[model samples]
Target: MTQSATWDYIRGSDKDGYAIAIATNNTVYESREVDPATALGLTFRHAFSLSDNLLLRSSLSAVHDQTWSRRSDALIWRERLDYDIGPLRLFTSVDTKVTTLNERNIFALGSFLPYPESFVTLSVLPGVLYRLSFGEIGVSLTASRTMFRFETDYLGLRRNNDRVQPNLFASATFWGIKVEGSLSYARVTFPAGDFDNLQRLLYTAKATIPLELFRLPIEKLTLELSSGRTLEDTTLPFSVINVSTLSDARLVAKFNPSHALTVFARRKDDEYVGLGARAVTTSLGAEYAYTFDGGLTAIVAGSWRYTQETGNIPVSSLNLQLGLSKRIDFSRTTTADASRATPAAPTTTR
Candidate 1:
């Protein structure tokens, strides 16, 4: 048996546009199969308005974990600067991270075994956005580099590997429809002479559409479709390149027949690629909720899913759930009362 506990604390200052968060997680194992572990994480973020047209923001995080025979530590930091001029905005950001893993125990049956490893990553992104009459369009370019090292006892040395990636992304929204796309290329090099260099390419695209029903109980409908593909090429002599494709699509509709009753339905499809294989899954789900006075609410949900894969038997499953919840409002003002008392913000004027 195992037990775990977690605690989180966050403090933010709206006047200064700064925030800090800290979290701790501890787990203990009772059985002989596993060991206990504890992890602590902290994050700090701040934003500064340099001028009426310029803004700067930065964030940093650190995490440390100690397990039976393994210890892990990581640190990440990012900074961004943005400047806006009329309908156009320009921004640039840099992110960097380092992670280290160490292991103390080497020989144990069914025990935690860790390999000493170190990883470092750095990324830079620059982008520009232009506001249109109806919506907005943005384009960004990213360059990233990562290095990984592993200590080997046999060679009494550490093996090094590195990868470099360059990516381009674009997004736009117009006429109640949103579209986003990205393309990335990566080159990986190994210095340990165990494997040859490799190259990989990835492409992804997504689109979202929202619809409103005027005369029906249905309030809104949202449809989303996305697809991605990855291609890999090896640098070894006479090595063949391989390509994998994945797709995901989902649709959701919401209905409110009465003030106290709400209903929703969703359909989703997902495709995953494996080694020379592909698997697909389709699911449909519906949920209904009813709220009564005295903070009582009841919900009923159902879902059905089907999965298919090459050279495997097709599988299907159905699930149904019922739940009830009670709300205890400790505040003197209710949500509706608060909304009525607070005035809306004024709109911007040109």
Candidate 2:
């Protein structure tokens, strides 16, 4: 069983050219196979609009996890800058994370071994886009490096790893059908150790089609299909759970019968390179949400899924969940109102 809560507060509006936000998330988990655990996260974000066409945003986050009678912590920082001209836009971002793990004994089994006691990873991406009549085309280059030190030899792992990749992507919409595709080449270098330098090419394409385009009665139904390896997220949350690191091809369909309800079905084929395993999963789910007069919102969701994996027995399961979310603005005053209320400086002595 797990219980979670989140609080978020914002002090200003992006339209005002400056804003700040603070948020916290806490979760408690109980399990029969493992000891109880608690996880806490705190984040701060700021946005500055230097000009109408220029923007700068930054965020800092810290996460602490208490489990197995040990505490693990991670700190992350990210910064981004963007500027645009008449038909061109340029942007750059930097992300960094430092993590300290103390759970080596917890995973004594065959589970993928955890990282070194401490590690740091940094990545930078800079890209440019050209707005086209139908959509846009862009190119981006990403470079990242990881460094770590281990007290004892665990898996013959090295202390240094680096990767560089350049990607080309484009998206366009035609007759109610939207399509997108990207191609990238990645080169990775590892210090003389357990692994050798390697290179690979990656590609992904997706398309979304609405039933209305075919004059079908179900105007709210839409289908989407995609295949490819997405960019990796280097955040603490994802890193802790070791999720979303697989490449998959997926097909999904969604239908909305009402303003507050939605239904969806999905099928995905996953490829786990590290484990040399492949799996297929299918699921159906629905979600409903309603807001009260006092601004509080309640949400309920449920799903049933089945999975088949190589060298493992097929399994199926059902899940139900409930959650609550709300956003509060501490600064109710608008920029224009604040400016007007500042009674013009006392008129110069006549």
Candidate 3:
């Protein structure tokens, strides 16, 4: 069994072009296949529009895992500047990220290390994009490096790694469906040079579509479809392999018969090339909520999931949950200004 909870708090007005957000997630896992453990994560994010044409964003996140005595932290900073050149829009983006991890019991010198090991990675990306009538096209160069912080560098271990990639990417929306694609050429080198250097061409493409765009007859029914594929390389870590491939597809549908009743279903499939793994999962769920006079809401929900993985038999499980929730809003809003505020952009999860 796995349980998780998340909390998010945001301050500042979107209309003012500045906002700060703090969030935390806590999770506990109990299973026969692995030891029971708990993990906690915290995140802080801030976004400020320096002007109508420029934006600055920063985020910091940290996670601690009790099962492995592991701690990980990451910081990301980004800036974007836009300019209108006649009918076309040109934009420049700068992004930087630093990630560090510390863990005990790391195997070294043919034995488990008593002290903790630390690893650090840094990445920088600068890109320029041009907006077209339907979509945008951009090119970027990324440089990333990783280092091991230990007493001595392991001889011939190839623990330190570096990569330089030049990529071309584009995205467009057509007929209410958004599509994105990218092509990259990556060169990976090891400081020790004991391992062979790698050079590969990687390509990825993704598409998303919402069924509501078709104006279906069904009321209060919503459906979404999304699929993505990475052909020669993947976004996975380079510590495992220099090149990998991944593919996935997902579909989700929801129906609300009334204000208090809702039903949802999801189907997903995933494949990994370098890992030689494939999985499929499907689930259906429903929820009902009742609001009391005092503003507290009682909720009941149930779901059944079926999963199958490569070289494993299929398994199915059913879950039922009950909860109570109350929401409190501290911000003040007027109807006229609320109506004129732009809607927040939709987010996608993979």
Candidate 4:
């Protein structure tokens, strides 16, 4: 069994804002397949308006996880500055991330995989956004560098590598559809020499469309599609290039034929490719919810998934769930109530 709890607080004024959040989770396992674990996380954020047209924001977060006899920790910090002109907005951000794993046992299929040692990454991003009639368009570029160090008694040696990545992204929305695209290039330098440098290129695109079917039983539908391709060129010692591609599509529909019941359906398909292997998966799910008096509701849901892979047999799975829930509103304040509760500022006649 697993249990978790989270709490958050926020304070804001005209020129400055602050927030803090913390979460703690514990998990217990009765079987031998898994080990008990406990984790805690804390985060803080602050924003300040440097001037009428300039704003600064920063955030810091840390997480600690303990499982069995092993422990892991991760920390991250980010800062951003935004400057706004009449019709254009410009922003820049910096991020630092660090992770350490102390001989942690990562279990997969009842087996232990290699435990990661530690890694640190630093990133800088600069972007510009322009408002349009239909929606908004934005372009951003990010440059990141990472150093990964791995050491284990099993390997009997320490290994270190460095990677640099630069990415460009653009996004826009028009005609009730949102589209985004990105291109990334990466170079990995091995401790051996420059001749062992690895180069990689990645391109990705995503789109979301929302529609209303007036004549059908469905009230609303949303469709999402995404695709990506990656190419990797190995070092001179290997002299090999590999290409991989991935595509995903999803659709969700909601229908309300009667006042007491609502129906929803979702479908998704995903396809992937690798050097010598390819796989495709499709999933279909449906749910029916019935509303009762006293804010009580009942839901029944089912899902089916099918997957096929090269040089492997196809697999299928089915799942079903039934649930009952009740709604509780602790705060009875409405917009009018809030407005009435706040005292208006005093005014003086000139």
- State which candidate has the highest lDDT: 2
- Model 1 vs truth, CA RMSD: 9.6
Tens digit of per-residue lDDT, candidate 4, span 217-277? 6666767788887643211112222345666665646454222222233333322212244
Residue 260 error, candidate 4, Å: 13
TM-score of each: 0.55, 0.69, 0.64, 0.59
Worst 10 residues of 4 by lDDT: 232-241
Using TM-score, rank the candidates from best to worst. Answer: 2, 3, 4, 1
Model 3 lDDT per residue over 1-350, tens place: 33433344455544232333332233333345534445555666556667665555655665555443344555556655555555455555555555444333224422333444355656677777778889989888878776656523322244566888899999999987888888888887777764457677777777776667666554434333334333221212223232334444444333332235546666665553344566677878776655565445555666778988666799887756555544333334688976785433211111
Local error of candidate 2 at 238, Å?
21
Error of 4 at 304 (Å): 5.3
Model 3's TM-score against the true structure = 0.64
- Give the per-residue lDDT of model 1 (tens digit) for 202-306: 788889887664445667667778888664321111221235565656564545422232233333332221224444666666555565655354555556668
**lDDT computed for candidate 3:** 0.54
Q: What's the count of clashing pairs in each model shown?
A: 0, 0, 0, 0
Greater TM-score among 1 and 4 belongs to: 4
